[model samples]
Target: MRQLGGTELKRLHRSWRRKDSFRLALLLEDVQSPFNVGSIMRTAAALSVSELFVSGRTAAPGSPKAQKTALGTGRYLTWSTHEDVATAVRAARADGYHVVGLELADEAEPLAAMDLRRDVCLLIGNEDRGLSASALGLCDAVGYVPQTGRVGSLNVAVATGVACYEVRRQAWADAPAVDSGDAE
Candidate 1:
């Protein structure tokens, strides 16, 4: 096959972008940094995550730092801003989504072993204070990315990306197998 030219390559990439579907959503609670929000948007878009829910004073999607960090990802993904985390979680659950929180509480199950399935929403908390009791209580399940090093935690965006990828990976694995009717 002939190699594509620069214009063709651009078109191909655009087609891929156009064909992308948002399967997952990232729910941020009280995340304070615009740069972090932007970074997460970029990662979410790359992962085909459909939407972002920014709650409890998390930086708005239109901020310059977020825009700069997102590197145009904002144009490809949808976002919603909310003042109440529990309300959002309830709304998601009512919509048939299984809510999951990414926090390291005593009750949190390890991310490596968690089951990530359809109709799910992944919740992320603030940079410093972590998730509030009310927010944590709203979730159906909570998961933690195990930490073995000296540092106690990861940046909110990094943790979000890790958790998102884990859910996506598990979803891929759990997909139903297909078979042809004609046998050998």
Candidate 2:
């Protein structure tokens, strides 16, 4: 077994990017920790999310602490911050994305069970508060990552990573195969 070098790593990802057919965006609502913001930014880049909508008190990736943690990965991502969650959700919907809220709220289905479409705008909430009632009302659907551990919820950043990956993994599975002519 061998690990891919930096160039090979790029090639591996390029293959997936070439085959990706769906669009995914993220909306953060009041997730205040810079480390978490930076982590989500990195994850968004890694997963090829088309856009990011940051709302409420979430930290911007350009902030010093966030940039330090993201290592400047946000430069590769397209993001915008809105005055509130509703406006962010509206922006995403205007861009043709299906808004799905990722929260542990009443009536939310399991993440894997959600009927995701080709373009998804995932709405995440504050680490402490989760989604507000009004924010939840803005979603077309709601999903939660089903957990069996002692903890009832996951860290905001970790949950974002998982949700983003799940969204792409579903789209990728249904996308046509494309060979980038590079050895894996």
Who wins the TM-score comparison? 2
Q: Which stretch of 10 consecutive residues in model 2 shows the poorest summed lDDT?
A: 175-184
Residue-wise C-alpha lDDT for candidate 2, range 52-74, written one tens digit per residue:
89998888768999988888898
Model 1 over residues 84-159: C-alpha lDDT tens digits? 8977776666666778999989999998798776656888899998899999998889999998999999999999
TM-score to true structure, per model: 0.82, 0.94
Q: Against the correct fold, how does model 1 do in TM-score? A: 0.82
> How accurate locally, in lDDT, is each candidate?
0.81, 0.89
Off by over 4 Å in 1: 1-22, 175-184
Name the regions of candidate 2 deviating beyond 4 angstroms. 177-184
What root-mean-square deviation over C-alphas does model 1 reach?
A: 5.8
- Give candidate 2's TM-score: 0.94
Clashes of 1: 0
Overall local distance difference test of candidate 1: 0.81
